[model samples]
Target chain A: GAGVSQSPSNKVTEKGKDVELRCDPISGHTALYWYRQSLGQGLEFLIYFQGNSAPDKSGLPSDRFSAERTGGSVSTLTIQRTQQEDSAVYLCASSPRASSGSNEQFFGPGTRLTVL
Target chain B: SQQGEEDPQALSIQEGENATMNCSYKTSINNLQWYRQNSGRGLVHLILIRSNEREKHSGRLRVTLDTSKKSSSLLITASRAADTASYFCARRYSGAGSYQLTFGKGTKLSVIP
Candidate 1:
């Protein structure tokens, strides 16, 4: 079975530029999540999508950060006006469902973004 | 802000020795999951312990959860060099009929061969 996967394993952009990171979740996964891992820091939750319900954007750091999952599968995270502070590895994970006891997110290889 | 804090930041042990990592989190959680990451790659799920459960074991890995203290510890016995990696504890919480996870900074473990 295919696990979660991200595209453009690495990306480099200039400050004030915009970059989009893509994620393909596992088949039949009803829940997807995005997180950011900065240098020497923990994984920070970004956004979440479950089935057809409204996505949870509470973890998004700023208005420049946004994401959308289409057809309950693929998701794209867009960072507008990229800053050096946004340089980090963006990770995507998916799960069968979003229940307390059964949810175990499968992570992707992640896309490392560098803003200069 | 992150919800959990991992102690010792890093650990190094002999191949035949055991490795232990501890985590402390704020607020209540429904479950705590342990994950291993190698070389900054994707994380692999190791074990999950529910709040009601005090301890759980998986192969050479043993996990103990103390809700009273909001802390958890992971022990890997007879660790091999292959086990060297970053270990993280993710806290799961449910709100508004949805579940979310918050991860700790992680402990970097180095198993010497």
Candidate 2:
């Protein structure tokens, strides 16, 4: 009955540092996605993982952005050499499945990352 | 690139009045979903309409999809002050190997009590 949850609701780090954001999808969810929202940029898809495989990583802006899901449950998004442009709200979402019939994705509160 | 584009960047209305938002996309989609975000927090899924459905309703929310025009609209009837927030439309591209939902710029709605 629990919804998707993310850790470190807010994170502040200096430029050139690395940050890892965690996401715990709802129970039984088989698909997880990570997105970033910046001012005036709207929602940008970063990466998606289904079960244990990540089929799509094209949306990831650069090599610094990487995500991995373990045991088909939790996922972690890591930003390496974080730049000021990477400052934004990192969102996590989970869906029952990736099929067309189950297209709904429940989102989490998000981790607000600030690069100083 | 963002798939959906919301018009009337912002709207203000009195309570009990209706609010309508439109979204336009560039590609054919399998489904279109509406979401609401309060302030700067996470987004809440409002509803989804498949490509074959012309219109669908859930409570006070009414959604219409036009595949020929590549657009969609969300109508909220008798809105309340609590409904003030940002509304976004996301598109599920109609193809395999790329099912990511692309979101729009969003419309900021302000409801006065």
| Model 1 residue A97 lDDT score | 89
Please list the residue runs of candidate 2 whose C-alpha ends up more than 4 Å from where it truly belongs after superposition.
none
Checking candidate 2 for backbone clashes, the offending pairs are none
Q: lDDT tens string, model 1, B26-93? A: 78878899999887878899999988999999999999999999999999999999999999999885
Instruction: At residue A21, give the lDDT of candidate 2.
Output: 100
lDDT of 1 by residue, A1-116 (tens): 88899998999999999999999999999999999999877899999999999999999999999999999999999999999999999999999989736689999999999999
lDDT of 2 by residue, A1-116 (tens): 89999999999999999999999999999888999999755689888888766458988999998988888998999999999999999999999888747488899999999999
Best candidate per lDDT, number? 1
Q: Interface RMSD (Å), each candidate?
A: 0.9, 1.3
